[model samples]
Target: MTDAFVAALPKAELHVHLEGTLEPEMLFALAARNHVELPWPDVEQARAAYTFTGLEHFLPLLFRAASVLRTRQDFYDLARSYLTRAAADGVRRAEMFLGVQTFLDAGTPIGDQLDAVLAAISDARTDLGIDGALIVTSQRHRTQAAALEVLELIEPWRDRLLGIGLGAAERGNPPAKFADYYATARARGYRTTIHAGEDGPPEYVREALDICRADRIDHGVAASADPDLMARLGDEAVPLTVCPLSNVALRVVPSMAAHPLPAMMAAGLLVTVNSDDPPYLGGYVNDNYQAVHTDLGLDRPALADLARNSFRASFDDPHRIAAHLAAVDAHVRANQPPERAYRAASAAR
Candidate 1:
């Protein structure tokens, strides 16, 4: 589709972290309200600090920014703000990741945070027309028991919460570390996804599938290094939520132009573009789309496929998925001049 059409097509985000969307302004405001001290006194300094050598460098700052979220209202406002922006970006359905372990580390009550965020999601759906679901994520750096504690805490809100995920540093702590927790979550009927092969190796992705039983893999970029694993992902049709800006910012890849998104797509993997931590990573969902399209030289049909895969990989109801896919198809058919499509794609790049 044309760049404008791609930007306008209704969509769903299956892999965004609620904490990661904390913009600098929101962070300062929340810190002031909660009486928390921030290392950066101004937004510019905070923005500068977003430049990272890797995920390890980014995690401490992410955790520190999260410290300002002390009250239920803080959580509610954070979620509502993101949902509002997502709606404006043409996201009709979103399944957001909530890093409860961060809150728990800061001494905030898990139940309070979940109640507040879930309440705001419900309100946003009614008022803003944005349908959202929560995915409570476990920090892979922590013990499996800690992950299980998060699952139990979220048990009451099971219907509103969509799934369980393993996020955070994916280096030493492989998916095997959280196998039992994911197993329990799966047995309880929760959907599963995990962070693997982003900074970790292809073996990590395998463990996520074989041990943790994850139905989806987030940032499985390193799968390209293993032909067997890549083939398995394509054959199984497991979706990979690839975040272009996040990868570039964290130096997981040298640059956006060098990203493996197109290759993964060509391999028949259900690759979906996402913004892992948009504000912090310097872009949102559409910005990610634009960056990858520009950098990887994606055409109209390839761009359409990415948009289509987004909804297809989402946990939204089948009817909603069909409706959004119809919108994408209509946009593609209406904007099919190959030359103009190429020019528009180049400009977007």
Candidate 2:
């Protein structure tokens, strides 16, 4: 019953990476189509190689799979496939992050990437009935100058992009380094989100908020370590786009049972569950919802709240957000089993 409620609940996915969505099956197909040689000869072998010691270990492998995406159609197919899956998972709105700098560095034209993705988004909205937007993510491993260059290059498509984001290795690369880039993005009217605290320290989360002024913090699990930071996040009602399966896959947390999502919510922060890299991490949004429910012992109400939080944290328009929130409420109210409804009525009495 809980599973059915979650699968049909209206929700928004706010932290997925487009390049990271490249599945092994699609990876091999694109490799053959583009005449690129993959490190793994077969899909089974590629799937077997997904183990990672940490974020650093996983990035190189992600980049290798991304190499197969060389054409505009490659990106179109990638976005379309992921959007289809997201719709099935009950994602009403999706804000996907694409690391534009990597493709630029690889010599793929910016127009080819953006045009294909935007086209996919437009078609998906029409065909799948899932509204979608893109966040042109700049790789943190690169210099701030490079990030600025990317910001400028994307200016032509600014109206199409939902926002700008900082992603990739966050260890030595602090959020402070991209302050100017973020400031510039904001000056140009782009919503800014930063990846922090997944692998970096609590200080990184602080910098993201105090320095970058991030509209949302992605993977802010580390903020739990600092009482003041957690309190500030709560007081500010800052949104943390938390990814349970991705955290475990990257070893940010030992397992789903040990995830800090429950505590994050308990602290009053606006926390939303997402599948950061669905294919690479072994789950999508609904999978993350079920994992937290089973492993963390979150009840149906808690799961519903998480779904509501997702819609609230999204960058979609206000009317749409309200409508989606209403939909979530309706689904929860309609799906309650008799026993649970009786309990709620009894508690109210």
Candidate 3:
């Protein structure tokens, strides 16, 4: 269908990274504001440097842009920009990922970081009427002890958080490495999800479910390779936050045409389309939805299914989720245009 129709559809974004939301303009502005030294001389140079072979190559770029965020307002401005953009894209709720270790390692005070993020969340709600929550994520490259330290830091700010998660490269650091970390978060009643099968095998998907007991799986597209794994994901109704553009941008698949979203849908997997890193990869939530609709040759009904799945897979409460889903269904009903009809008189003339 048309991009305008897709843009009007209500949805929720579940896989966005705050650091990944750093646009080139914001990067340079924040750098100048914070007086941070830079490797790139100008914004155009920084934007052109977004090219990458894979996630391994992208991590350094992510960190380099992230270096500009030093003070609490830096974090606040970063989050506020993302939330405002998300709101413009019809995102009713944005469950964003923030690896606090990035700021902590940069020597930004932990409390300052948390306070700034929370303030931005509150600002999004009050200013834009968009519900935003943070899922405090840990970098899997680090030790499990470090993961626990993040959990410990989040304890006081639990009211401000939606859950805890782990994400980074998936090859060497399996989801099982943070089993106890997940357990502690779970015990404290935090909803959990972990990255699996993005670059790892299907076995990592199983570990995330069985060991980590994750509420969802991020980029579990590799499950398409094994029928049994696909069946398990379908049967369990586990939500997979699939980022089509990000995957293609990172060469996870050859291109959007080769994405497994259609297969995952055929297998009855609860798949939600999201923008993992919008600014770096380009586009936001609605942009991702539109891209998949075109690349997969999906029609209105299929797009609606994906849009509804966004709310269904979200961490929002029952009333809000129900309202969003109903709104999506309503939009689908109203927007499905009719086909061309023949006019006998006009044809004769």
Candidate 4:
């Protein structure tokens, strides 16, 4: 499919991190605004440092950039910028993960951070017509008690939050570590998602399901390693927010062509394409869609399926989800060639 077609397709972004959306220019701007000194002297140098060998290599830089976000206004600008970009890329609904615990530990009040981010979401809904909500993600490397503390901390704004997520280095911090945390979040009526299988094993994905009872799995490409896991994901229709560019950028896979997304689709899994951390990872949602279409041989119809899957996998209301899915169908019908359109319509059946 053409890049234009992919960009025009209606979709939802379910796995973006607000901190990770910090563009180099904005990083420099925010750093300057907050009177913070960055190690990189220029934007080009900052961009150059985006290279990474793995998630461990990438996270330090991610958190370091976050250091510039010292005020409520800083968080507002970051969230607004990301929502604007997501809207431009035709994202109808976005569930963004904010590293609340990071800032909470930094001594920024939870109310200050949520106030700024929720304000951005409100403005995005009004200005861009792009609806979204925040997911307060806890760092996995930290202790489970710390995660539970975060859970308790977010109780005040539980109504504004879409869910809870576990992020960061996943190797040693298994999903089971957050089981009690997720249990408490669920008990309090918050949906749960866990970052599994990106830097961790397939067993971590299992724990994310069995132990944490995660409503969704982020970077769950590791599920492809176990045939049983693949079957279970397909049968259960557990949504996986797979970030193709992030996988390649972080060396989770050798390259985009080597990503297991195609295999996951073959196994009938409910997989949605996302930009985990676009600025650091190389591309946004549209870029991920374009990469798959070019490198993985996903045709126009297949790309549309990815878009539809995005809405289907979202935590948005059922009525909104149906409308977005219908919008995707209409977009495909209008954009694709007549023969391709007919084939796509048939394929949906």
- Which residue ranges in model 3 land beyond 4 Å of their true spot? 338-349
Worst 10 residues of 1 by lDDT: 1-10
Q: What overall lDDT, based on C-alpha atoms, would model 2 receive against the true structure?
A: 0.92
Residue 286's C-alpha lDDT in candidate 3? Answer: 81
**Candidate 1 — which residues are off by over 4 angstroms?**
1-3, 337-349
What digit string (tens of lDDT, one per residue) describes model 2 on residues 37-124? 9889799999999999999999999988898889899999999999999998899999999998778878899999999999999999
Model 4, span 34-62: residue lDDT tens? 88899999999999999999999999899
Ranking by TM-score: 2, 4, 3, 1
lDDT of 1 by residue, 107-136 (tens): 889877999989999999999988899988
| Candidate 2, residue 66: how far the Cα is off, in Å | 0.2
lDDT agreement with native, every candidate? 0.88, 0.92, 0.89, 0.92
Against the hidden true structure, what lDDT does model 3 obtain? Answer: 0.89
Q: After superposition, how far is residue 301 of candidate 4 from its true place, in Å?
A: 0.8
In model 4, which range of ten residues has the least summed lDDT?
1-10
TM-score of candidate 2 versus the correct structure, residues matched by position:
0.97
